[model samples]
Target chain A: DAGITQSPRHKVTETGTPVTLRCHQTENHRYMYWYRQDPGHGLRLIHYSYGVKDTDKGEVSDGYSVSRSKTEDFLLTLESATSSQTSVYFCAIRATNTDTQYFGPGTRLTVL
Target chain B: QKEVEQDPGPLSVPEGAIVSLNCTYSNSAFQYFMWYRQYSRKGPELLMYTYSSGNKEDGRFTAQVDKSSKYISLFIRDSQPSDSATYLCAMTDNAGGTSYGKLTFGQGTILTVHP
Candidate 1:
């Protein structure tokens, strides 16, 4: 909601292929996060970055990796797409601690 | 047990009715609480945020947090059809600022307000 944009709003890929989703923010927020949403399940964190080049894995980070090379950009990569990874991906950013997170529209990824 | 528990109700209400959504967490250390609303096929949008115990009201929405009981609630004073969506509760410890992204979320509850 806060000047965040996610690229490739929808994607269909084959298993074993790699896919990258990009999150770009115009607000220069210091914190960025990647999460996946599935039916009946809450948004599960994949990875997050606190500052440029500082990243940490989340509860569901097995096959995913994240990079934050700049203040305005965060990238999430699925090293190898799988059917189980098919879901809606979201990017969120926060400018201060304990503050509300602003989210990008989202990217729907489907791997067959 | 899951750290956060929500009913995930497909709760239906008539227009202008008051609606309540709730979540209970197991982590006693969690001090920050929040509620988010997500429309169908859309990303979750924050509706309410509160820290510690007590309540905070904004416009027609009120958020309540009870750290002693490890529970949180969101009340909509006059629910309308526009309010229909999936409501999610998120919590963290010292979950403020531009760092420390460890907030945990509960399965959202689906609410429908009929006219």
Candidate 2:
């Protein structure tokens, strides 16, 4: 397992509140991604960063945002949380491609 | 249609049984197909990947991809209790994997290998 850790392994927040999940990697990989896992849907990419300050929207980016200020840290923030946004989020990092992707444990966020 | 489709099967099998998991995609541009195993409440771990079309075997796991049919499969021989996890099918195209491997994932099939 790659040394990847997600902070606030679990969190509960009120609707319309702001929440941020953090992913820190020791591998210093070039690519980092944020994805939300729902019951009926697989992991849906919210945003990803190819390098510091270089990011792009994913299919499910409408309600989410991301930032990668430093190579080791990637953050996913819900500007204003909604009940529909309750889901488990995962972070993945790869050296270059998809040959091997190490995942952080996960962050379970619930918007009440 | 979604790029990838997999039956979210709660497929149950007895210990030592052979288990088959699969996913199908519509994109012919997909060149890399991968299978990930995810335990509950955890992130997905890569299991197998087959570039283009063919079969690759490792340990008790076999991965098969038929690009002509846009179908990919993972077969586990002699399933074990530790193998009880959600199997997700993911694919990356030259279109998606360029900058970083942007993969499209299936809903994931839950499997339980019992004793």
lDDT of 1 at B89: 95
Q: What are the per-residue Cα lDDT tens digits for candidate 2 across A1-112?
A: 5889998899999999999999999988888989899988888888988899999998899889899999999999999999999999899987564545668999999999
Residue pairs whose backbone atoms clash in candidate 2: none
Model 2 chain B: lowest-lDDT 10 consecutive positions: B92-101
- Candidate 1 per-residue lDDT over residues A1-112, each given as its tens digit: 8899999899999999999999999987888999999877788999999889999999999999989889999999999999999999999987464556778899999999
Q: Rate the local accuracy (lDDT) of all candidates.
A: 0.90, 0.89
**Per-residue lDDT over B1-115 for candidate 1, one digit per residue giving the tens place of the 0 to 100 score:** 8899999999999999999899999999888788999998777888888889999999999999988888899999889999999999998876564447577899989999999
Q: What's the C-alpha lDDT at position A1 in model 1?
A: 82
**Model 1: residues with Cα > 4 Å off, grouped in runs:** B95-99
DockQ, all models: 0.70, 0.61
Interface RMSD of 2: 2.7
Candidate 2: segments with Cα more than 4 A from true spot: A97-99, B95-98
